[model samples]
Target: MSGEPEVHEEFEARLKTYEGRPAAETGVGRDPVNEPMIRHWCEAMGDTNPAYTGPDAIAPPTMLQAWTMAGLTGRPERAAAYDELLRLLDESGHHAVVATDCEQEYLRPLRPGDAITFDSVIESVSERKTTKLGTGYFVTTRTDVRAGGELAGTHRFRILKYAPARRPRPAPARRPGQPGERRPRPVVNRDNAGFWEGVTRHELLIQRCTDCHTLRFPWLPGCNSCGSAQWDTVAASGEGTVCSYVVMHYPPFPAFDPPYAVGLIELAEGVRIVSNVVGVPYDKVRIGMPVRLEFRRYDEELVLPVFRRYDEELVLPVFEGVPE
Candidate 1:
């Protein structure tokens, strides 16, 4: 009764069957929501809100996923249906995987000593679609967390499993001895245009919520605390320490060289920004190493902010790339 078998139609039908299947059942948290973990998270994120501290402290709403993590040992209660679905995709040639995004909704505050548990389901599977990364189905999983048998929050995580598309970028046309292609410009919009504008004037600006006065970087339109949209700018002290860092060694882009250190700099003003850590060997870069701000010109047209250690001589030609 079937004509020539449809290629993707049959595969998609099989995927749809797995939707609503159990992903995890009654997954218990390894530890109760407590103060130490909250303190560590706040330190790493440079969050100084007093609401997260003191005897009356409550866990940050963003820590919803932390209490549910299974850690290095892996989750024991994970259902097989999710694994089987992923295996089905792997066998069908969509092998590479990337987490596209996630969202969380908090219903109530989590207090210390509160026991936590969660259950997850394969929420949805999208029909086949092509993207710049490649062609694949988007799989979404929804996890509901409970404290003392009461719903506390929900987390929705989405990922793309696909066979990567082959992309061949040709060399840019140039006269002899000219520099390589100029660096990828950071995407500037209404929310972040002010930050970039400060860079032009050799100043680093951090956003402060007018209501709660909590400082934040990478400039969001509204404060995560109190949801206040009113904000003001505070110029940074230019003194910072390398809170964390990673060295990029593979998958070189056109405007960047491999084996350079990128760091999360914690400024004296209690906010963090990401920038290239130059003037030192990549391996020599270490956490807690002090860094200071400096603006470097890559060419006549582009200039960017970078941090350098006090000991190393200034280096030229550091670059940052915008991912496709």
Candidate 2:
């Protein structure tokens, strides 16, 4: 991470030579197109399209890059040109890297049991560029993913490798497992102050667009349906169903238990809210399960909204049912 800033004039021309060079040659997929991975992807994306399921199931077209992804060991037969280019950038003090975006074009449908392979080329390397992140070049790679010797898709990926413009603010060391370590506080701005105030009184309030009367969640400043800035608050019934959920198991955070279920509850009013589902084991959390909202006090100053299952008595669901 430590490197002296070198003269940009010395290496800028060298960076241009990397354009149109091979990045990866004949990179093979770690796994063949299969049903289990497709099923998992569908479940997580909440994509219920029948084309992704049943007999004659073709992999989702949007999953073009997914089929060619490399594992931790990295791309098989990766060309040295890309490596040297990145090293040159690193040596020039552009050590931070982040993927910006990707564009995919599907040429053919990829079915299960299809073997995937790809070849990538350095599409372009921009000259010294300065952005909010810092000064560095934007490197783009174009990959042609193939199946059975036929082009199945084209994936264009872009990344920014740059030096940090400024150091990030230091965070206090946190021990989430130990008692009394506080979770980071939420930002209460002018636009969202009312929502937090409603939480204090244990009222789940949603914004209703004054123009179209459409209900919106998380207290948006303007209505998405009609683009109206005028809106009013509507008290939710707090009864809902689990539309989707995820079990967080890694990268521990303050005051949170790992492997916990975070549910997206579709409320009776038709809007959805995301909160922890506490009544059942994390693994037992199921889509379409009934849930009811409740306010929980984590500490004297922190009270959060969580949900409990309809049938399971693992956790009590008590809201006091105050009049809205």
Candidate 3:
């Protein structure tokens, strides 16, 4: 409202000029459709379907845009009109860019030896809108892909060019004895309701398959090993060893202290569970340290199993017989 009205009007007029204009046309793919690229794509996606391999291979439909990429040198087919539109946005302080989403439609399969080509047009430009990232415009472009002179796919991509908004820093974590702060609530569904119920009663329960005798934690309805739905609970021996651990330090949250140790505890029953390793400094927590399970009440309603390491004095004697 404070700036010159004529200048603002000129900017809007320039942006509208790009709509329905060619962003890129008569663009030829740098490489022909081949099996090697398809194999690499399938391997990276963990897609092992037989149709994507061997003599009958067809490139994955999602690779429609990959064929038309400009690479590091950029596309010569791009029109100067698209570049001018972006330059105008940058001049208006909307410099940052992030791709929002994309939609694709495949009409025919792309097979080996098929040459690829494409044409793209500026689809639409949205009115200025305010978002968490800041105020910006949404620009959309639609590309039509052709293979062997036939329509193969259509891809629509949208991006937001914005001036980023500043976010306030997160609140500091509350101290151990502070009031008005609680741990994040656990997600309890029917599949794991029994496990949470067991915790409320100061019991650590593991599910055991009734048919195959295999035990699993984080309770599930069916046994993954045998696909059996029959199962029962077993009380743990309350003994375990620290098999692995990690220290969290970033993106501090109000509910958790930074630089705390979370460990994967291998229980004596041959199953593993994750819990906070207490009774020792976070930095001192090591793999294979013997620990015993105990219940801790964070507040009146929450009680969880935590592992406590044996006192350092008690563990030192066991290592005294060996050389340092």
Candidate 2, which segments miss by more than 4 Å at Cα? 1-6, 174-324
Off by over 4 Å in 3: 1-10, 167-324
Full ranking by TM-score: 2, 1, 3
- Report the C-alpha displacement of residue 1, candidate 3, in angstroms: 12
Q: What C-alpha lDDT values do all the predictions have?
A: 0.84, 0.83, 0.82
Each candidate's TM vs. the true structure?
Answer: 0.49, 0.51, 0.49
* Rank list by lDDT: 1, 2, 3
Write one digit per residue (lDDT tens) for candidate 1, span 1-324: 111348688998999998999988999999999999999999999999999999889899999989998889987878899988999888776777888878999999999998999999999999886788877889999999999999999999998987665433545674322565567768999999999899899999899999999998889999998899999999998999999998875445666665578999999887888898876777789999988899988766677989988644436533334221
State in Å the error of residue 189, model 2: 56
Runs in model 1 lying further than 4 Å from the true structure:
1-5, 166-324
Span of ten consecutive residues with least summed lDDT in model 3: 315-324
Candidate 3 lDDT tens digits, 16-59: 88999988889899888988888888899998888878888888
- The 10 consecutive residues of candidate 1 with the worst lDDT sum are 315-324
